[model samples]
Target: MYRYTDFDAAFVAERNAQFRAQVERRIDGSLTEDEFKPLRLMNGLYLQLHAYMLRVAIPYGTLSSAQMRQLAYIAERWDKGYGHFTTRQNIQFNWPQLRDVPDMLDALAEVQMHAIQTSGNTIRNVTADHFAGAAADEIADPRPVAELIRQWSTDHPEFQFLPRKFKIAVTGSPNDRAVTKAHDIGLRMVRNDAGEPGFEVIVGGGLGRTPMIGKVVRDFLPEADLLPYLEAVVSVWNLLGRRDNKYKSRIKITVHEHGIDDIRARVEERFALLRPAFIGVDQQLFAQIKPDFAPPAFKDRDTAPFDQAYSNDPVFRSWADTNLSAHRAPGHAIAQISLKAHGATPGDATADQMRVMADLAERYGYDELRISHEQNVVLPHVHKADLPAIHAALKAAGLATANIGKISDIIACPGMDYCALATARSIPIAQEIATRFDQLKLEHEVGDLKIKISGCINACGHHHVGHIGILGLDRAGVENYQITLGGDHTETAAIGQRTGPGFSADEIVPAIERIVDTYLSERDSADEAFIDTFRRVGMTPFKTALYGESDKKQKAA
Candidate 1:
């Protein structure tokens, strides 16, 4: 993990101090709620359904053991005992009082973290692959690039206030684990024809009211030209991007309105001017940041013990099958600590659990942690020999939920409960579905399903790409959810098809249950997952079940 330099430390403390004073001003009426709203939001504070919610950025989703402990501390001291990890690779503290957020920022600054750019229309948190350094198929660790971009984008004079919130994601691996297709700017680390590493830049891809897959602006952006090229892309968008209509304000729309060729041409024109001016930091700055992310040295222990353990423990075998990922290092695996424990909230990790994970990270694994886009915590580079001990320690902390990629592992946004723009609730809906599935123990039977929920058409919860997608809507002040089926998010990604009429908030769960039951009865085999069956048969059964109707023949008659 990258430690903050003194300059970084001082900057955060200064920002926190300013925020603390602002909070005092707001409480004393020197700042009205309207006056304070933007200021508060700029610092990652939100006025939620009940109380204020504070979102803290975990840049590139990498955290040190110490930082994890601090997050746990914040969860314990300020708000609810639990914190929700979000799809953007950020964490949200759901119940913080407005007055306490400044203090929370202060605490974060101590660990070289802050909430700046966590919110606001400015470029939001720069996210990357969770398994950056540890992934077997990485070209260069994307974090250094992410960090460089973070520093560049943070309060950049030019892009401080864009037409809309800008998001950027980097992935070192060729496997596209970072959901690059769904971001405003997607930088996939790639090699040129000559084998020199660079970025394959994709622009315009986003999931919103208008979901469009991004187009490649640059086929191969060289290593040294990365920052300048990115600046060029943003500059072109800032100048030519939409501003009149908020719906069409995104860069994706800009790219759509003006074709990729024009955008690329404009970007190239912009790049020529910007490239020469960035003489301050080049490969040297990267060289400085590289050492901070040096891979941890592990004991060259025998893997024979791990094989023996797996043979003896069937439970561990199942967990290993579902939760473990390959690591770059020999005899090591990345461990996913699933928050989707049956009936519990999908991404809520308690303060105690965070502490336990920190301890586990320091002890059994490398003193490193990652927050997955699927709302799970990852302990990257854990020795296989430590799996038993790690499992036991996790079990003790109530953090050993072996439900990674299962039905219970849902991705949801802070819908009506927290987001001001939400028309319906997402968390509670996710909870209901998870609980129902757990009670039936039918997650395994259902198999490899992604049930995503977004409060509205913004699609932050990624309802557009879910295997069984649910979008919450407002129907005359009543919360309703629309279901979409047969969506995918991989190389085979597609928007899910809507079954029929939307269901009331209360009715959505049982409706989902009916859909699941229909799948169970109609499926070819359990081996054929919900998605495979949906692809094979189409949405007729699920639609019939949801709409409370007979076949189309009866309707036509």
Candidate 2:
């Protein structure tokens, strides 16, 4: 909820004006497609399979009602009537005309939002835990630090064109809902034994063709040194990160090739030089931003109506049990609005639904909303008293899906449908699995399963960290789906292990069912979650379930 200052407003306005002129030049043939590629990417515009895709940054996944309304307007007025909320805590307008992009950017600017740094080789959107300020377990709101990174990285001269695209994420809670370990620089807000809040910096972690968990670079960094230390980390990478091979150019690769200790030493050397340049300016900004993030004035109210609704409506009870999280306030709860309605496209919210969410936020959620990395919208501070009303509105708008962490709550990238780099379709695979689970009525029974699908190894769906990871590939022009078991996107982050053989598109869903069936059979009880069971039994039983003993022996052979 950080409002733009005059300088911030002017900066965005200037960037928009420049981009608008650049777009006009491209349209007029002054700039060819090849000439315009980098320019367009710099402004978060990409030419996808069918049309221009504009990714707009929802910084740290925080949005006000007004901003939400603006996005709805953009979706309705320029592109298709829906926007795809991505796993990176950003939204993608998949069918925008190149001519309409400048107007879209201008509209976004009016609401303190923009497409800047949403794409390209520069630091992309800085993300944080969706439950940043409202989560009960948080040590501090990580958004302040995320915002600080946003300010520091935006149009930073040194990082304009790094070795490759960089991503950063922060999480306030020890639960690690933000998938911090999968980012270029992962900052976990923590306090030392002395009780001073700071960051637990992790580097080298990423999920792609090669998945590796990030290593702890600094055990505990003081709050004051965050920006400088981050600069040092990136500075070291910029100087030594591979440039010849695009596939090997990420900071994660750099950290992997060179040991963490060497990288840490280099970062410290750079930190000594950059520390003075910050000179208290970033902390001053942090102080200015902190006041805006003060917790909402929560009302003290009875939960009688909520209890009545829960008892009277089984639908409401199911949704509340699955989608709601405990809040720090006595009467408030965090409401996660599922974008993944059964068989529908995951993360694709219709304009009307967006408008409904905006209205609900304004009326019942302290005018705030958050986009979860799992492709759901979160009303972070909804009072228990408002749950019934909010649920009713969401149900009417087709935004109410009871599945939260269930098998149907899938994370899928916009694969062959929209992405040019994809070899196979991911959306249909996710749809098939979700629809299959829904038909079987097995989601609740399965319990707390994460199914992430990627069209390719780029891992935009974060398949590597999924409890059940599916990677889609093109094997001899045939769509082949590979499964990885035991991946976790939490404090205990680990890369999933690949199971035996890839399944055909038609075979993938049933393969997943077998895996789930295996889990259910192997679990101590239903109380044990899918992930817990997987970790307990390891991958053998699941592999045996998916590929059988003969197939496993054949694969091993």
- In terms of lDDT, which candidate is strongest? 2
The ten-residue window of minimal lDDT in model 2 covers 547-556
Q: By how many angstroms RMSD does model 1 differ from the true structure?
A: 2.2
Candidate 1 ranges beyond 4 A from true positions: 517-529, 540-551, 554-557
Q: Candidate 2: where is the Cα deviation over 4 Å?
A: 552-557
Estimate, for each residue in 1-557, the C-alpha lDDT of model 2 and write its tens digit: 79999999999999999999999999999999999999989899999888889999999999999999999999999987999999889999999999999999999999999989888889999999999999999898899888989999999999999998999999999999999898888999899999999899999888888888999999999999999999999999999999999899988889888989899999999999999998898899989988878888999999988999999999999999999999989999999999999999999999999999999999999999999999999999998988999999999998889999989899999999999999899999999999999999988988899999999989999999999999999999999999998899999998999997899998998899899888889999979988888888888888788877887677689
How much lDDT does each candidate structure score?
A: 0.87, 0.93
What TM-score against the true fold does each predicted structure earn?
0.94, 0.99
6-98: candidate 1 lDDT, tens digit per residue: 888888888888889999999999999999989987888888777888889999999989999999999999987889999889999989888
True lDDT of residue 431, candidate 2 = 92
Task: Tell me which residue pairs clash in candidate 1.
Answer: 205-214
